[model samples]
Target: MVRFVDVPRMRHWVEERGVETVIRGIAERIESDFRRWPEFDTQARVASHSPGGVVELMPVSDSRRYSFKFVNGHPGNPAAGLQTVTAFGVLADVASGYPVLWSEMTILTALRTAATSALIARTLARPDSQVMALIGTGSQAEFQALAFRALLGIDSVRIWDTDPRAMDTFERNMRPLGFSVHRASDGAEACDGADIVTTCTADKAYATVLTDDMVRPGMHVNAIGGDCPGKTELEAAILHRADVFVEYPEQTRIEGEIQQLPEDFPVTELWRVLRGEEPGRTSAEQITVFDSVGFAIEDYSALCYLDSDLGEGEAADVDLIAEPADPKDLFALVAAGANSTVRLG
Candidate 1:
């Protein structure tokens, strides 16, 4: 029996434990795994792009466990009364290659993404930073707001979105959580006097959500929207000005904001920073950017954490794998189930 946590069960688990607690736990796990970054086999996700959106398979493994996620991104999904992104994942035993856990990763992805942003910002953002300029108040807006507040002690957020309804929703949702939510008329206005600028728009084309002129000195940019080829939030000029950090350079050059720059443009891997091999925020005046293209190892960590947490709970179980009574006589097992004792070997 494989443990399965569908959407409803996952929601219940999160609600019972609280979002902040769950996110913080996941963040701790992610940071812990990142410290041992050299142990895992990592690679860029395999993506299938269409005119509407992209479907991706992100996989990672260590010596003990293998994990993968199937996810999709479609900006037009909201208009069709669907989510912009949805995902599911599996965790399996490496030796037997049998699934040990199955889970709905749509909510998990949001949680992990927000946790990752906060984890990175803790290193890249200034120590005194409290104000955040959150552009694009969509599905991920509230999650980012909460993570930053919980992890970085941010007390205020100035948010902006092209869709007024979405901005209103973000404000309504975040204010109850004790955040000073401010609505801005434009992206530039949202970024004013802010220490961290997070762009999380859902668009399939290159967008100038944050221009170079709007950015100030000594600011940290959490760029999470430009996760696929040809989909970006910040302008090319901003990339030229900021010192960028990424998950994997080869993958980020193909899918992240760095895709807009020359092939040889310099960027640092974030794990190196976590391992103290590279500097994160060198000085007070230097601008830092975490060009976030969600990596597979992050999902690996999340799955591992969930598997441990859900193991003791009364989570539902599904018979995902068939068991043969005799290892070598698989057909005999099927024949027995059909009430026929056939002698066929």
Candidate 2:
């Protein structure tokens, strides 16, 4: 039997412990994993793109367990009364090759994404950074605000988006949580006076949401929206002027803002900084860019974090795997159960 943390159960679990606790916990996990990044198998995620959107499978594993997340990104989903991003993931034992835990990842993705950004910002951003410019106020905007507050002591957020209603939703959601929210007239306005600039827009185009002028010295830019081919948020000049860091250089080259740069352009893998193998922010005036194109290892870490929290509250067991009485005679178990259950109506 596979233990399951379905959508409703996952929501209840977060509510029981509170989202801030979950964010802080997952941030710790991400930091720990990044420190020992070479111990796990890593790869760029495989994606299938269509006219509608893109579907992706992100897989990563350590020696003991393997995990994968199935997710899709469709910017038009909100107009269709659906989420722009939805996901579910499975964690399996490597030796047995059998799934152990399965969980809904739509909400978990938001949490992990925010946790990841915060974790990286903790290392790259200046210690005195207190304000964040949220350039996209979609499903991810509020979480990013919360994560910065929980992890980095950021209390003020200057926000903007093409949709007024989305900005309204973001302000309504974030203000109650203690953030001093300010609505900006445009992306440049939002970036003004912000210590950290986060661009998480969802348009599948190479749009310059943040130009070089918008980025100031000593600022860390968390670019999370340009996560696929032809999708980018920052102006290429911004990346040229910043000391760039990434989760995986290969993946980021294809799906992150770094794609706009020359193939040989310098980049430091974020793990190196986490491991103290490389410098994060070399000076108080240095600009740093975390070209965040969500990686598979993050999903792996999130699943591990969720799996460890099992039995803390109500969790459901799902018969997702077949348990054959005789491991060698898998056909026999299926034959035995096929009688009344397979009756022709």
lDDT of 1 at 318: 97
Q: How many clashing residue pairs appear in each of the predictions shown? A: 0, 0
In terms of lDDT, the poorest run of 10 residues in model 2 is 336-345
Per-prediction TM-score, please?
0.96, 0.96
Model 2 Cα shift for residue 223 (angstroms): 0.3
lDDT tens readout by residue for model 1, 1-345:
999999999999889888888888888999989988889998889999988899999999999999999999999999999999999999999999999999999999999999999999998999999899999999998889888977998979999999999998987888888999889989999999999999999998888899998899999999999999998888898888889999989899999998898999999989999999999998998999999989998899888888887746647899988788877877875675674467776
Clashing pairs in 2: none
RMSD of each: 2.5, 2.5
Tens-digit per-residue lDDT, 1-345, candidate 2: 888998899999889878888999889998999888999998889899999899999999999999999999998898899998999999999999999899999999999999999999999999999899999899998888888888998989999999999999998888888889999999889989999999999999999999999999999999999999999999999888899999999899999998888899999999999999999998989999999999988888888998997664467888887778887877886685566566677
Q: What TM-score should be assigned to candidate 2?
A: 0.96
Model 1, residue pairs in steric clash = none
